[model samples]
Target chain A: MNLRIIKSGVLDTVQDQGRYGWQHIGINASGAMDRFSAELANALVGNDSAQPVLEMHFPAASLFFEQPSLIAICGANFSAVLNGEPVPCYQPILVNKYSILQFERLNQGARAYLAIEGGMNIGKWLNSYSTHLKAGAGGHAGRPLSTDDEIRLNSSVDWQSYLERNEFRVLPWRASDFWEKEPVDEIYILPGREFSGLTELSQLSLTGKTFTLTPQSDRMGYRLLGDPLEMQNREEMISTAVTFGTIQLLPNGQLTILMADHQTTGGYPRIAHVISAHHSRLAQLSPAEKLRFRITDYSMAEVLYRRQQQHLHQIRYACQLKLEWFIHAGH
Target chain B: MSLTIPYHIFPLGDSAMTVDFGSRISPELNSAVMKLYHELQLTPLPGMVEAVPAYSSLSVHYDLLYCSRHRPAEQTVFEWMGELLDKRLRKLDYEEIIPSREVVVPVCYDISLAPDLEMLARERNLSVEEVIHLHQAAPYRVYLLGFLPGFTYLGETDERIAMPRKMQPSPVVAGSVGIAGRQTGIYSLSSPGGWNIIGRTPLKLFDKDREPLTLLKPGDIIKFVSISKDEFEDH
Candidate 1:
């Protein structure tokens, strides 16, 4: 079975939990910027979280399904429509052969995850299916999907009789616990290694003021514009290791949050770091969105992270039981 | 444990932690950073993912969900990992050094291929031949790999050949051998770069199909060998 791309959207590429254990050689872990949503998409389709999924941006790719399959859409709500009919996200849907899936308009978020059961038949580089754009390796010939590109499907289910009366079927069960969370406009963070190097005013302003994500942002980093921060004294820092969610204060006094594809090391002053649990919220935020930073303790961060983990676990378990029953019913 | 270097460990975020040596670039400091990185990789903590070594610091990334759930209830994952790292550092023996791989990178310094070679030599009040000689005189240590893949940061070039980065970034071809301040590097993939390019290497520095992906790794000792234009294209 092959899924044909009718129209490719901006920055649409194959992504998973990202390529890891290669940063020491300047290789970045270019995976799904929002892991939770990607994982949720997979779980909803009864696939493992590490399976590769189609990560699309606004005006996402219009696809032609070659066979009947169970799939789910998560992350940014681009108002996915199947064969001219609007399909809801965060739940498994039985898509019939020759069905056209399209993302009509940008209703929310910057990127979306499309996960199919048994995953896409894509090649992996460095043991990962995530596309490393810079290196031009991994996933669909290591490039963004263009029109007429065909992606093979690993497994196909016979949902013809089950969906005989309709073009598609939206399953009753949804990953509610996984999909619902506290609305996250305010991003939670912890002080970075160089947080204290900033002037007292700058330190206070980081949390006190709101910053706008500039258009210069991408998979590498999110450039933020706010008060020009400065340090007590000008000191040249030796380059050091940085990670995803590290908020570095540039020499120009502006700030940039390193994302999934951030360099292994940086020389800028790291002022704060966005908590792990809020990375999904941060990744979904489109360019030009305003966000406020809140300084929280490590204890609070740990609690929130554990809560998010529990949510993922619950959703995975809930979907497994429902998927078993649904797949059997289709037979 | 001959702990001569002073270092501090801190959390980059809840998911990652870093151990930094003092703020300076030297063989001694980088050796210590690599040692810690090697130790961490060999005996990783519970849920440890990867350890990245830089000029004078090492960042340790981990599985947050695993660490958070498996760590002692009283201690946060950060604290638990920090304590583990502290124990490792306290017992870290810096006496034995990890064997570094020696690599010879060939650079074609013909006037046509070396766009900025003349300019760099004129500014430093030296001839182009002098600049090339100075650059190739010593074996530089590969301190770190960042900014780009296969773009190894080999350091401590002769001061006479050192130059600041270009005011504006320009398109640099892959295998461009360039210098910025006292450090020199080879451009792994073609992109915009600000370094002072003196020559180009014919070797494929960053091929995804290549074993290890990158030609050089941290703690590597690399030197540049001058070659003619014919030699550059022959390979």
Candidate 2:
């Protein structure tokens, strides 16, 4: 069982919840930018959330399925299509062998995940399937998918009988956007240790003004564009550990929100951090997208996080039940 | 004799906290961080994912969700963590110690290998031989590992050879020995750096195949031994 890339996307790679417990050696956990969708994709297919998924950007890869299999396309609505027929996003589908899958239009969001019944047949580096772009290890060949890259599937399902004559069959159940009610423009953040060290104007601007993410952004971080933020005093600081969502003020007076592939440590002054709950939504925002910072406390951040996790937990349970029922009822 | 270290714990983010000893890069401050670091390795906080030790601070990364659910009803996760660290500190001074590794690395100080050696020597009004002698003279402490994997920050170089970082970054090769301010370090991998390159080491600082992953770790004491050009390639 395999999937061959007919055409590659702008940026596509394998990622999971990321590699952890290696920061001591300076190796960071470079996982899915939007973990909620990654997990949702897995849940839809009855696969564990920790399994690796194919993360793709707009102009996503066009692939040909080599075997009948179960799959789910979650996150950014890319107007996914199978054999020229529109397939709904967020729903599991039974894909027949030789079926050509393509993304026709960019509906919304920045990244999308493709989850099969099992997972990507790729080597794990440092106990993670997530691709470390800089180190050139993990994932499929430790690089972006290009034309002719064939990825064998770890799928265990016998879907040939279920597919029958249909090239693809979209399952009835689907997931609603978990962040539907949240405002996209306001990204909640918690002040960092050096928050007070920033000059008063810079501090005010953080919440008062809107900043646009620049094209310079990638897995490393999202560089923001707005009025230059200044510090009260110029100080030589030692490098220290920083994590995903840490907003560091550069010497150039700009701010960068560290993302999935952020190095384990940094020398820049950390000014703020996006709450964990908002990371999924924030990661989906493409370059040129604007957002304002909203300072929040740890307690509120904790509340938001638990709610998000709880919703995901419900989805996983409902999905497992649906998948089990579907499997029992013969096609 | 062991000294009682004073420190303050600050919130790094919602999911992590850092214990900071006031900023002065002395072994005294770093020893406290290493002591805490080694202790955490042996006995980590309940929800801690990992702990990162730096120049004068230790960042404790934890699972916020896990901590919240596991903590006592009255204390918030942060408050509980603070209390946990407080208890750890109150129980002991630095007298109880974990043995640290002492490593000796060889560097080739040939003119071809040392890009900034001639310039650095000229700036300090010293000979090239004097520059290498000063750099390799004292045993330096590995205070932190950051910037890049295995790209260590060894500190308190001989005052005569200690120089500030270059105004602009220079593309340095793997194992490039460099100096910036009072600190000396080696570029574990090929990357652009601002430090003055004084020599090059043949040893691999980082190798995934290696069990330890990095050649150096925080709290290790290190020395640089000068070697010949032919000796560099032979390694």
Candidate 3:
């Protein structure tokens, strides 16, 4: 299957779980900002969890499907439309040859994920299909898709037969369980190594007040505007490795939460880390969104992470079973 | 001589932990970090994915699922990892030899290539020739690779020419050799930088097609060799 980019909206790029095992050498793990949605989209189309999905920002891409293929859309509802008809997210859709899919406007969330059956056949650098924009490597010539760009999909033999047998434009069943409700905007974080470095007043301010995401926010980090969180002492710290959810305090008393495209290492003092379970929800937050932080311990964080992973595993298994049954019934 | 360094392990998040050797930058501390990094790589514990060595610390990232499965049921992932790291720390032989590479970086110090050469020399009350001589005279060590891919942070420059970063960062071309404070490095990728650009190199610090991607790894010894602009262009 082939997809022709009709209108490449702002910051549309192919991303997977992220490039790992390379951070030691200063490589950012550039991946889907909202992993939960990306994985769900892939699962809806019976694709592997690590398969590359189009991570589109608000006012997402418009594409032309060159062949009949099974696809899924998830994450932010960008008012997706197929051939001028509104299409719902969190389910598999069958697009006929020459059908145009377009996203009109953002209904909710900051990003969206679009997945096709058998995944995108894009170039993978450092064992990942993620595009590291700064280095200009990986995923479709290491850059965002532009108008007229053609993205080829890994064609599956069974898909051709399924398309011929099916008359409906979408699967009867939707992966409704995988769809998360609207976010509450409350982010839970665990105290970091330098949590104690913050002044007592600053520590209280972290949880007692609200913070707004500043305009300077990007994939690298979200520079928050709120109370100036001051540290107890003016101490110098050596640069060290930082991860996706690391919250760092700048010298000017500003707080920045490192996101999906965060640098491998940073010198800013790490104040806290947003738990892994809430990462997808955090990714969906846009600039100027009001958010509050809640303190949680390590054990609680681990429990939440494990529970989410278990939920995803169950969802994947169920989706695979459903797809298998559907294919066998068609035969 | 055998040397033993003390270190502390702290949790960065649910999925990562950090082993800090010290707060200050020094050859000994960096070597210690590299040694620990190598040791961990050679005998990786359960769930350990990667170990990132910085100037004086090593950040170890792990897979929580794998760790939970392998760890004792009674202990949490953090507790299990802390204990496992402590055991490894006790067993590590500081006397064990660590491996490193010596790399020669060719630089073109022509006035045209170095946009900030005249300004830097004037600010330091020295001739441009003197500045170039001091930069290439000493062998520098790769403290870390950060800020950008393949951008190696080399340290311990001769204090005579040591200066601060530019008051404001401007657009720097790739392979621009820059110096700020006690460190000098070549920009692997073109981006805005505040460092004083004293020369340029033809070598690509980072290439995706290359085997290792980066030209210099941490702990490698780097020696700058001055070459004429013609030599640089020819290569």
Candidate 4:
């Protein structure tokens, strides 16, 4: 099966989990900004959680299916249509050859994922298919998909069963089952490397004040506009390794939330790290969206993380059980 | 007696924990970080996924679920990790050395690429020739790699060539050489830079297709060789 791009939209690129084992050489682990959504889309189509999928930005992507295939759209609620008929999201559906797919602007959320059954066929770099835009590596010649670009499945995997099972609408199933569907705006965080550098009052304000996400946001980091946080130290720091969700406190007292495509290292004093459980919200937050950071202890953060994992495992198990039932319950 | 190294282990973000050996930069701390990194990766914990070694610390990435499953209720994961690191360091054999490659970077000290060459020389109270000589005098060590892909942040800049960064950042084209404080680096990609522009090299510090893509590795020695624009273009 294959897909031909009609309109490439604002930004669209193939991504997987991430590239690991290379940070010693200064390579940042560039992967999907909204990782949970990416994983769900992959799981919906019976693909491994790490398989590559298309990360579409702000909708506007249009494609033509060259053959019948099973596909799933997950993540933000983007207005998607097939052959001018409004299509529901967060479920797998089959498309016949030459079918046109269009994605319009979303009312909320900034990014979404579209997963094909066999996953997008792309050259893997350092064991990953995700594109690191700055380094110009992996996925579609190390660049975002442009107009007229064609993407093919890794293998000629037949989706006859999938098509037959899922034809009209998404099976009476839930996409949030495999991932999270809770209100994600309330971000949870743990004190970080420079958490002590802030004044007690500033530390108190960190949990109290609500900041709005600014327009200056991307895969690199989020520039938040809010109360200027005060710090205890003014010393310059030697550069060190940093990662996504690292809340760095700048000299001017502003907060910058690092994201997926964040630099491999930084020198700023970090105030906190948003908890892993709250990262999906970081990915979907649109500009001007108000966000609040809830300070929690390491133990509590770990608990939340374990809960997410248990929830995910249960969802995967439930999905399998349902699939088995579908196969046995008289066609 | 060797002074007890004061350190702290804290989170970098939700998924990462940073163990800072010291608040200040020193060769002792760097070696300690490298040593701890080797030991940690050798005997990793249940959820420990990746380690990012830095100048004065090692940041560890882990899976929260795995960590919780293996964590003992009596001992906090943070305390266990700290104790584990301490034990590793205490038992560490200082005689071991990691293999590192030696890289010689060629630089063309031409007028075109070094747009701020004259200005930098004037500010440092040195002749252009004197600046060039001082820059090429000592071998620089790759202290850390960051800011951009394959950007080698070398340590201990030449005191003579050391100058403050450009008051106003210049839009430097890729491969431009620059110095700030006791450090020097090449802008591997076109970026808004504040380093004092010295010259540019034709070397591609980062090439994705190449196995071991980045040209320079941490702990490697880098020497700048002066060349002409013709020589730079030819390569």
Candidate 5:
């Protein structure tokens, strides 16, 4: 099965979990920025959690289906139209051959995931299909999809049978079911290496004051506008390793949260790292959305992380049972 | 040789740790970094996903789940990392090391790209030619790649070329070469920068088309070669 890109989105690319093991070679782990959504999209379509899926940013992509297949849309609910019909998201849908799927505009949030039953067929480097655009590696020629690009699928199953057997609407699964949502205006953060170096007032302001996301935001980072944070001392710390969710303070006292596709190392004094538990909230935050930081300790972050993992494990078991019953019915 | 190693280990974040070989930049630390880097690559601990070696430290990324599963009796993964670092440095220094490959980068000192070359020369109390000569005189090593993707942070420029960054950063053109403090580098992509602009190269430092796209890597040595505008454009 092949998908022909009629119109490319702002920045759409095929991505899986990510490429690890090669950070020693100076490669950052570039993958789906909101990996949880990517996994859920795959799971909804009876694909493995690790399967590669299309990551679309800001919609506007149009594609033509070459064959009948099972698919699902997860993440930001962009306005998607299938053959001029509005298609529901977060569930499996069966589309016949010659169907045209057009993602017009992003009505909410930034990124959305499109997962086929099996997965996207792409050449792998270092054991992943995720593209590291900076290093020019992985995915389709190691870059974002362009107009007229054709993407092939690995699945050869008879997915058309789903049309007669199951409802086309999404099953009862929402990100909120497995992970809790953060306050609309508050972003949860864990104090980081330079947390103690901030002036007492700056420290207090970090948790109390609200900041608005600037337009200068992308997969690389989120720049914020707010009261400038002051450092206790003016010492310039040596540059070191930086990661996604790392909140770095600039010379002008502005804050920038490094996101997916961020550099592997940085020199700025990091004030905090958004806890993984709240990363989805950060992911869905739109430009100009006001957000406040709430400081949490390490212990709480760890406990929250483990609890989320357990919920994910339970979801996986439930999906396995659903698939087993479907197959046994035909037998 | 007596095997006594002194290093500092610190928290990079909750999930990872960094072992710094020294407090300041020096050749010893660079060697220590490479030595420890190779050793870790040869024998990575359980759950360790990556070991990123920089000018003075190595950052290790590991899977917390696997690390806990294989947790040793003596310490947590963080403590075990510290102990392993000590053992790694205790061995005899791996002398007769692999020589860093030299990459000659062609740069154009033309009027358009180096718009501030005259101003920079006046601040440094030197002629433009002298500035270019000093920049090309020494072979610099790649210290790390950061601040942006494919942006190479190089080490050890001739001290005569040591200068503070531009007080007000001009919009840096892509491929512009500049010096800040004692380090020198070329801008791989156009972004806001304060480095002293001396010249520009035509080579695409961060093109997505090339395999292993970046020409420079840590432990690699580079020398800037002055070229005519035509020569620069041809490459």
Candidate 6:
């Protein structure tokens, strides 16, 4: 199966879970920014959790399917339409050959994830299909999708019979609720080792204030536009390893949170880390979005993460069973 | 001789932890960090995925789900990791591993490739030849790789030629060799850099399709050998 890109939309790229075990060598773990939606899209179509999916930013892509295929769209609702008919998010749908899938505009969130039934037939670099744009390696020629680009899909069991029955068929079930639809403005964080380096006022300002995401934000980090935070002492720290969600306080008192394409090491003071469970929600936040921080302990953060994992596990199992029944029934 | 360097391990996030060796950058501290990193690579814990070693720290990334399975039901992933790391730290031998073959990096210091050589020499009140002599006089160690893939951060250039980074970074070419604040490194990719460029290398520092991907690794010893522009092109 193959799909031609009619419109490449803003920053469309293929991403899996992430590239791991290579950050030690200064490689960024580039992957889908909103993993919650990426996984949901895959689950809806019975694809593996780590399967590569198309991550489309606001003003998403328009794809023309070359073959009848089963697909699912999740994450930000971009007001998707299949052959000019409105299509819903978070559920699997079958599209016939020559059907055009277009996303008109963003209804919510910053990104949308589209998953094909058998995953994209893309080559992986360092064990991931994620595109690291800076390095020009991995995923669909190591860059964002461009107009007329053709993405190959794995050949699954014949779906031509199903397509003949209907031009477009919507699955009866949807992914169970795990992520919140409402934009999450309050994000929980844990104090970093250098958190104490900040003054009392600066510390209070961090949790007791709202900050706007600056236009300077990108995959590397999200720079906040608000009151500059100050540290008690201006000490030069040796460069150390940083990870996704690591919050660094800049010299100018601005705060930046490292994201998926962040460097391995940073010199700025690390003030806090956004909890892992909220990383997906944070990824959906666009520039100019207002957000407030809340302090949480390690134990509470762990509990929340485990709960979210359990929820995803249940959803995966349910979807697998439903898909097996659909196949066994010869649909 | 074994060195006893004090270090502290702290949680970076839910899935990662950082072991900070010290605040100052020293050969001993870097060795200690690399020693710990190698030991972990040899015998990684159940869930540990990667351990990134920097100048004075090592950030260990792990799989939370895999780790949670091995820990007691009541224990959190962080607690379990802390206990495991503590056990490993207590038993580290801190033996330095010597490289069998020295990696010789060929550099062309000709005026065409050395964009900032004159500026760096003027700032240090030394001749361009003197600057090159000092830079290639001694072998440098690859302390760490960061900022870009395969960008090796070599260290401990002669203090006489040591200088601060430029106030504003200018666009640098790939394979450019630069110096700033007592350290010299080769830029694996073309990027805007603050470091003063004194030379360029013809060899590719990073290649995704290559087996090792990076020509240099942490703890590897590097000796810069100056070559003629023609020699550089031939290589």
Best by TM-score: 1
Q: Which runs of model 2 end up more than 4 angstroms from their true locations? A: none
Worst 10 residues of 4 chain A by lDDT: A160-169
Residue-wise C-alpha lDDT for candidate 3, range A156-262, written one tens digit per residue = 74465666654326777676633355455989998988999999999999999999999898888899999899999988776788888999998789899999999
- Residue-level lDDT of model 4, residues B1-235, one tens digit each, is 4445667776565556778887666766777777777777788755787888888878888766666667678866666565665666677665567666678889998988898889888988999999888988888777677787777787777777788777788799889899988778888888888998889989988787776688776677888899998999999
Residue A160 of model 1, lDDT score = 73
Backbone clashes, each candidate = 0, 0, 0, 1, 0, 0
Error of 4 at B10 (Å): 2.8
Q: Give the CA lDDT, 0 to 100, for residue A207 in model 4.
A: 88
In angstroms, the error of model 1 at A201 is: 1.1
Candidate 4: where are CA atoms >4 Å away? A155-157, A160-169, A177-182, A324-331, B1-6, B41-45, B95-101, B167-169
Query: Chain B TM-score in candidate 2, rounded to 2 decimals?
Result: 0.94
Which of the predicted structures, 4 or 6, would earn the higher DockQ when compared with the native?
6
Per-candidate TM equals 0.97, 0.96, 0.95, 0.93, 0.87, 0.96
Clashing pairs in 3: none
| C-alpha RMSD of candidate 6 | 1.8
Q: TM-score of predicted model 6? A: 0.96
Which residue pairs does candidate 5 place in steric collision? none
Docking model 4 quality class: medium
**Quality of model 3 by C-alpha lDDT:** 0.86
DockQ (C-alpha) of model 1? 0.84
List interface RMSDs for the candidates, in order.
Answer: 0.9, 1.2, 1.0, 1.8, 2.8, 1.0
* Per-residue lDDT value at B155 in model 5: 74
Question: After best superposition, candidate 1 residue B165: deviation in angstroms?
Answer: 1.7
Kindly list the per-residue Cα lDDT of model 5 for residues B1-235, writing each as its tens digit: 5544477776554456678776566766777787777778888866777888777877877765565446675565556655665666667375647577889888888867787778877877988888888888888888776665567778777777688777887788778888888888778877789888878988877755567767777788888888998888788
Q: Stretches of candidate 6 above 4 Å error?
A: A176-183, B1-3, B96-101
lDDT of 2: 0.88
Q: For residues B131-154, could you state the per-residue lDDT of candidate 3 as single tens digits?
A: 999998989989999878888788
TM-score for the first chain in candidate 3 comes to: 0.95
